[model samples]
Every structure is written in structure tokens, then in C-alpha cells.
Target chain A: MKIGILGSGNMGSSLGLLWAEQGHEVFFGGRTTEKGRAVAALAEQGTQGGTNDEAARFGDVLLYTIRGINPAEVLTSVEVLSGKIIIDCNNFEIPEGFAYAPIELSLAEKLASQVPNARVVKAFNTMAQEVFELAPSPLKDYQVSVFVCADDAQARQTVMKLAEDIGFTAVDCGELRHSRLVEGLGNFIRFMIIGQLQNPYTTLSIDVLPAASEQRLGGRQP
Target chain B: MKIGILGSGNMGSSLGLLWAEQGHEVFFGGRTTEKGRAVAALAEQGTQGGTNDEAARFGDVLLYTIRGINPAEVLTSVEVLSGKIIIDCNNFEIPEGFAYAPIELSLAEKLASQVPNARVVKAFNTMAQEVFELAPSPLKDYQVSVFVCADDAQARQTVMKLAEDIGFTAVDCGELRHSRLVEGLGNFIRFMIIGQLQNPYTTLSIDVLPAASEQRLGGRQP
Candidate 1:
């Protein structure tokens, strides 16, 4: 799969490396040429970095990792990603240092509206950037659960396979309405860090020992 | 020490029953006398259930389990609760449904404001009602972790002893502002259920084992 990543900051670059390492043709779409080339050069799997339009046109799967506030204008500006499986990882809250609620519109839902024909899925928004970059598998043999939300079944299935490729347990979270919860979980990670007086490292990832058939109802204690 | 519960709903009543069974004088309060008595009668600890005011006056330390939307209002209505050590367990998110970002006031801060003399420390917001009620702790052998947050040093230390009595692992989460993350983690639990199409019973418990001393500073491996 050819992966196109818009916004070559820490998150985009980190994930871009993962996809490229997973035998995917990864392309970088940075705000500047230097960043794009620099990220492209970091690839061991022939990852190439290009303009947003060029990267958008060159890939089968795209990741939207831009900041929350300006995603609409940025996506509109990137017009290259007209129709594709665009994974929405952008969150809406700004680091204004004040906690607000009733986040009127979600960045994912807003993107879906703008690109009606595109297959958009919401994920990775629930995890910390560092967690996304690190955090080992919760399940030893199987995969770590990743909550995925989208109206399109095919799109979700495709994304799930990608999650598996990247070593994850992809749990289908009903529809786009769930993106609200996913993003909420993401922001909550930040809150937990401050609460623990621990530097933001990522959420505490649990190692789930698989249950026997009788114990499979849910991950409850015996 | 006597235990006080500020709500007679499933969560509050459930914990009240457990504490009373453990031979503690438990006072559980609800909006109505009827609801409180119904739950308290089942406990058989001579547990008293009455108006919120009665619960506030009854307990040595108060456990607040009300909705976050109106923590200030709840405190205002129960004015006698001033100057007490409060177990603050609430999140201020709009209940209509999950919104990506909560566009409202921070309820904990509001709570701090309403009860100026009260010593507010956050705890019990992360557990499932079932875990708080039924998860047996073999006395520090396998106690669950619950983070505590507050500005006052004495209040935090006092709650630490109270938390041990309740069979939990209470980690002090810095100051009052840190309360947001402890409460925010609750949003992750809420969203995980909403996002993954799972129930509270099955999904809420994230069995976080004690982070090994070396692991805590080393890395967050869950």
C-alpha cells in the first residue's frame, strides 16, 4: 500500500516511518521542502516525500495529522486528496492551556463533510503521540485493540488490516459519532499525565493475557 | 471512620453497601428520601439514607459522587459540607452524548470555588462501580490504583489513609488542577464503551497492575 502523510511533524513522521517499515510505499507531505526531503531521507523502505498534492495523488492510504484548528483550511488547500482512504488523526483542541468542553464540531466529521466522496476513518486520536510511536502490544499473540470508527464498512476493514499490519487490535467503534469518544480519550491522556505528575509518555498500556473459551465473555476477573 | 456517599444512584449505593458490610458507619444520600432508604435498607448496616444535607453532616469525611455538570450547584445546595475532606469523583462533560471536546467549565475548579474551606482531593472517578463494590482486595496484596489530586498537603495525606481503608492504591496526582486528568481518564472509559460498542460491565475495567518501581521511571508499559 502506498501511504501519503500530510504534515511532517513528529506524529506524521513517526507514523510514516511505521507504514514504510511495514512494506508500504510511504510519501511525506510537509509544509516545507526541507522537512519533506528530510523525512523522506529517514525512510529505509524507499519512503519519498513530496508536496501535499503530489503525496495525496501518489498514495492509496492517507493520514491527516495536522493540528485541530486549521485542518479544514489545510485539507481544502491540499485538494490533492480528493478521493482516498484518509485516516483522521487530528484533534480539535488547541494547547491554549485552558480546558474547554462541548467541542462543537469534530475535526474528523468536519473533514468527512468537506470530502464527501473520500473514505475517512477516525483512529489514533485516542492515543498519545508518544504512545502511537511506542507502546508495545497489549496482547502477546494477537493484537492490541485499536478503536476504529467510520460509516463505510470497506473503509473500516481496510483500516483494520492496516492496524493489524502495524500490530494492533482494531475494535470497530460503530459509526462516525464515536469519533467524539475517540478524540475525547486522546485529550484525556494529556489530563492523566498532568494528574500523575508524570511527564507525558503515553497512556499506560496493559498486557492482556488471552482468556479461555469460558472466560472470553469479556476481560473480567474470574 | 464513617463513610458518606452523596448519591443513592447505582454507583453511590453500591459502594455504600460494601463499606457498610465491612462494619463502617455508612451514610448514603440521594435527592429523595425514598431512594436513599431503599438502597440503605438493603445494606443492613443501620446505614442511613436521606437528603444530601444529612449525608454531609453525618460523615467525618465526604465522598462526592454527583454529576460534574453541576458540582458547584450540588455543593451550594449542600452548604454544610464546608471545611470537610472531600473525595471528589466527578467529570464535567455534557451528558447529551459524546462531543469531541467538552465545551464547558471545569467542574472540579467550580467545586473548589463553591466550597472555599473544603479540602478537595480527587479519587474514585476511574473505577467501574462494580470494581469499587465487588472487586475483592486481599489487603494490599492486589489493591487497585486510584490517583489523588489536591492543593493542600494535609488533605492529600489524610485521603491516602482513607483510600487504604477502602482497599485501593491511591497515588497523589499533584495539585487541584491535576484533578482534571484524573477525571479526564474517566472520559477515556466512557468513550471506549461508546466507541467500541461495549458495555460498562465488560469495558470499564482496565486492570492496571502496579507499575514496578523501576518501570515507573523507566517506561510506562502498562
Candidate 2:
């Protein structure tokens, strides 16, 4: 599957490496062809790079990793993003790291409205750069959860496979409205972790207790 | 010390019963003298019930369990909460069953402002009513956790011990501003539990890993 990464920042590059390592065709969407090429060259062999618009057209799915607020411009800057599975890994946190409640419309909502016909799913917004670096699943030889929320069932299935393929346990957290809870949890941690307190190592473990029976999710870690 | 609980609801009654059980002079504050006496009669032996003003004056510490939006009116109706340790358990969420965010002043800040000289500490704002009723402590008894946030150290310590005496594990979550995260977590769970994805019986147990080599706060479970 061709996976396109929007925004060639640290997160976009990390995802590109992960996907390319898994043998999927990974594309980096950058403002310029040269920037996109730089990110692609950083990926494993067979990975390709292109301009933001070219990446959108080239991939089967497009992932949004830009700042939570930056997608508004990036979506419009690119000519079209309709009918593509857009995974939102962005959050609308104000500058200076103050998590003052959430915004009027979540980033996913705005993206869905702005990019008409785009199948948007909220995932991977709650994890840190290191957690992505350490993606867990049966694919990765462990099980860490990746929560997926979307209105489209097929779109959710597509996202789930990609998540599992990339090596993380995928749990569908119901429809898109649940993104409010996702963003709220993220915001709470953003302040709690970034704001700095005791046990500031990795903020929190995204893994849930595996119901005592499921060995993969949880079993005698303590 | 005489302890007062305004708004004789389940929460108020729960705390009052437990605290009175622990030998604190607990008073259930109701609207009128007769109403207070009726509830008091239903309470454990030696537990007192009185009018709102009388209860507020009867106790050295007052715990306000009134509605979130009208904290000022609620406390003012109590008549004499000034210069007392009034524990706040309020968060400003809309009554229409939606996630409400406070833009102007947070509920903790508002409660502090409402009771000018009263030393207001935020506690019992993180757990569900059921969790509070069970009363878990770090010592291995049914230990329910209640995060505490306050500006005054002595006042916070005082509340922390009171929380322990009533079978709760009070984690000092920094100052009052940090109460925002606990409030958001509590609100998030309030909806999440009803949503059924999360196991309501799942409790977050804060323990020191053996590597950390920390002893239990409540000592040990039975």
C-alpha cells in the first residue's frame, strides 16, 4: 500500500521510516520537492518522495502530522485530498504549551469539513515521538494499543490494518465524536507531562490492562 | 475539629458519614434547620445535622459539594464559610450532558474567588462517587484516590490527612492550577464509563515499582 505523510517534520519522517521498513511504499509530502526528497532519502530503500500535492495524489492513504492548527493551510495549499484516508495525528494546543480546554472544532472535524469527501480518522495523536519510534503490535513482536476513531467503517478497517501492519494493537474507539475524548486526554497529558512533575520519563504508558486473559495486551508486567 | 458539609447530597453524606466514623464532628448542612435534623437523624449516631448557616459555622473546615456554576450563591447561602478550609469538588461542565470547557475562570479559581478569605483546596474532584464510597487507601484497604491541589502547604497537608482518615489516597497534584488536569480526567471518565468502552471496575493503582523501592502510602492491603 502507498502511504503518504503530510508534513515532513520529525513525526512525518519517523512514520516514513516505520512504514518503509515494513515494505510499504512510503511517500513524504513536503512543501517543496527537494524537502520531500530529503525525507524520502532518509527512509529505507524503495521509499519515494514528492511535493505535497504529488504525495496526496501518489499514495493510497495520506497521514496528517503537521501542527494541529497548521493543517488548515496545508489542506488548502494542496489542490485536492478528497476520498483519501487522512489520519489526524495533530492537536490544537495553543502556543506556550497552555492546554486551555479544547478548541471550538477539533482538528479532525475541521480537516473533514475543509477536505470534502476525505475519510478522516483520529489516531496516533496521543502518543509521543518515542512511542512511535517504539511502535508495538504482533507485527513489532509486542502489543501496544493504537486507538482508531472514524465515521467510515471501511476507512477504519483500512487504518486498522495499517496500524497492525506497522506493529501496534488497534482498538476502534467508536466514531469520530470520540475524538473529543482523545484530544481531551492528550491535552490533559500535554499539560501534566510537559508542565513537568514527578516521573517525567515518557509521560504515560498508552498500553491498557489486557483484561487478565489476553496475554498480549497485559500479563504480569508488574 | 467540627467539619461541615454543604448540600446534603450523596457525596456530602458519604464524606460526612466516613469522617464522622473516623471521630471527626461531622455536620450535614441542609437548607433549613428541620431539613438538616431529618437527614441528621438518618445519619450514624453522634452525627449532627443543622441549617446551612449553622453547619457552616459549626465546623472549622467546610467541604462544598454544591453545583459547579453557582458556587458563589451556594457558598453565600451557607452564610459563614469565610476563613475556613473549604474543600472544592466542582468543575464547570454544562448541564446539558456535554463536554464543557471553561474559558474565563476555571471552577477552582472561581470557588476561591467566591469565598474570599476561605482557604479553598481542590479535592475529591478526580474520582467517581462509587469510587469515593469504596474508599481505597495506599495502605491496602479499599483505597480510592483523590487528587489534592492547593496554594497553602499546611492547608493541603491538613486536607491530605483528612482524605486519608476517610479512606482515600490523596496525591498532592502540585498547586491549584494543576487541578485542571484532574478535573478533565474526572470529567472524561464520567462520560467514558457510561460509554462502556472502559471497564468501570478498572481502578488505577499508583504503586512504586520494585526498582523504585518505594513503600505503600497506605502501608499494605489486608
For each candidate, the DockQ is 0.20, 0.10
Which stretches of model 2 miss by more than 4 angstroms? Answer: A16-25, A32-50, A68-80, A93-102, A137-149, A153-181, A198-222, B18-25, B32-47, B58-60, B69-79, B92-102, B137-147, B157-182, B195-222
Write model 2 residue lDDT over B1-222, tens digit each, in one string: 689888777678767877876788888888777767776776556988877777788888887888664445544553466568888887555334454553344577677876677888888765445544344232225344567878777778889999888666666666776666666655655554545345543333222122112323322111
Candidate 2 lDDT over residue span A1-222, tens digit each: 888988878778877778788788888889888999998987547777877777888777888887645445665454466677888878666446463653455677776776667889987765555445444322243344566778888888888888887766676666776666667556655554455443321232222223323334222221
TM-scores for all predictions: 0.73, 0.72
lDDT of 2 at A58: 79
* Candidate whose lDDT is highest: 2
| Cα-lDDT of candidate 1 | 0.64
Residue-wise lDDT of candidate 1 within A36-81, one digit each (tens)? 8799998777888867666777788888787654444664454565
> In model 1, how large is the Cα lDDT of residue B1?
68
Off by over 4 Å in 1: A31-34, A68-79, A92-102, A126-129, A132-145, A194-196, A204-222, B20-24, B29-54, B66-79, B88-101, B107-114, B126-128, B138-188, B191-196, B202-222
How far out, in Å, is residue B220 in model 2?
A: 34
Worst 10 residues of 2 chain B by lDDT: B205-214
